[model samples]
Target chain A: MWTFLVTEIMFFGGMFMAYIAYRHAYPLAFAAASQKLNIILGAINTTVLICSSMTMAMAVHSAALGKKNLLILFLIATLLLGGVFLGIKGVEYHDKWVHHEVPGPNFEFEGADAQHAALYFSLYFGLTGLHASHMIIGAVILIILIVKASKNQFSAHWYTPVEMFGLYWHFVDIVWIFLFPLLYLIDPRK
Target chain B: MSDHIVPVRVYWSVFITLLVMTVVTTSIAYIDLGPFNLLVAMTIAVFKATLVVLFFMHIKYSTNLTKAIVISGFVFLLVMVFFTMCDLLTRNITAPGR
Candidate 1:
């Protein structure tokens, strides 16, 4: 898991570098682009993800304690929180799609240095899209775990899968933790 | 395979701390700290991440080998970021035309 997270770090690290370089090159444009993002939604989503991480951690704890019902309950709660996050993200993306903020010919940022602003949206989609994909996968894993946990398949002696999934879910939450500030709260103009 | 079960109180406290930090970060972002804005935001973020890592992920209760592996991941990430920034920030200094 540690090795896999390292590779994931390198993966997201490159994009982070790109974002920093572009933000450095076009600070004003980046700021303007960032202002268009919905900070409230972003904060709420951050909280939701954090709560999900807590629930996931608790699920692992429950599994470790051989508490089958608590494990299933927490797993279900985590799954629901993950779904709410994606739902909010879908709303944000739909807003952008309607506003034509997506990076393409239809892309438009009514501000100085629109070109770099477009680059901001590009990274925005790339980073959040990847993060959301991980959330989807995590949700799927939680569903499977929920089923197995309901069947009393896990116990204190053998809950490695639950612990591993906790790591993965927390990692995903960590990614969003960074993404929230970088993408949403980065408005220098505010 | 030493399994340590963290108390619910720790998890709840960490969650509350993370939420508080999130609020603090958002408030700080609006304060116009000049160049310190980014630094402040990232510092808060790193702190929050540490809380998550230590408690939520149970790295604090992990074995020495597990800790070493996790620390190495961050070390390599630092190396990557540092070298990459060095190249990026110094590119103009060694430009062929300059």
Candidate 2:
């Protein structure tokens, strides 16, 4: 699990480096692009992810304690929070689409350095899109775990899957921990 | 293998702290901190990531080998960033001759 996560780190690290390089090259454009993000939605999603991480951690703890019902409950809560996050993300994407911020021919940016601003949105979509896909994958895994949890397939002696899933979920949460600030809070105008 | 079972209270407290930091970060972003804006934002982000990694991910209770592996990933990423930035930041823009 650690090995897989390390690889995932390297995967995202390259994109993060791209983001940093562009931000350094086009600070004003990046800041302008960031100002267009919905800070409220981003903050809500961050809170949701943090809550889900808590539930995931609790699920692992419950599994470790052999509390079958509590484990299931926390798993369900985590799934619900993950779903909420994806829902909010969808809304944000849809809003960007309506505003013509998808970084294509129809993409629109006003003022000088519009091209550089488009680069910011491109990186934004790339990073957040990858992060959202990971969340979707985690949600699906939580569903499988929920089914097995309901069957009492886990116990204090053998809850490796639960612990592993907890690690994965928290890793996703941490990615957003960085993403929220880097992508959303750079320039919270109003 | 018996793993450490963190108390429910710790999870709740960490969750609250994360939310508080989120709010603090958002509030600070609106205050126009000049050049300190990015630095302050990244500092808070690193702090939040540390909380999630140590508490939620249980790396705090994990073995030294696990901790070493995780830290090494970041170290490798830092090396990549350092080399890339060296190339990016040291370029001569006015050199027209090959």
What TM-score against the true fold does each predicted structure earn? 0.97, 0.96
Determine the C-alpha RMSD for candidate 1 after optimal superposition of all C-alphas.
1.1
Candidate 2 clash pair list? none
* lDDT digits (tens) for residues A88-157 of candidate 1: 9999999999999999999987898889899999999999999999999999999999998888789999
Compared with the true structure, model 1 gives a TM-score of 0.97
lDDT of 2 by residue, A1-190 (tens): 8888999899999999999899989988998888889998999999999888888888898898899999999999999999999999999999999999889999998857889989999999999999999999999999999999999899889999998988888888888988988999777466
Question: Which whole-number lDDT from 0 to 100 does residue B50 have in model 1?
Answer: 91
Which structure among the candidates has the greatest TM-score? 1
* Per-prediction share of native contacts kept: 0.56, 0.81
Q: Per-residue lDDT for B1-98 in model 2, tens only?
A: 23676777888888889999999998898888787878898999999999888888888888998999999998999999999898778776545663
Predictions in order: lDDT: 0.89, 0.89
- In model 1 chain A, the worst 10-residue window by lDDT is A181-190
TM-score of chain A of 2: 0.98
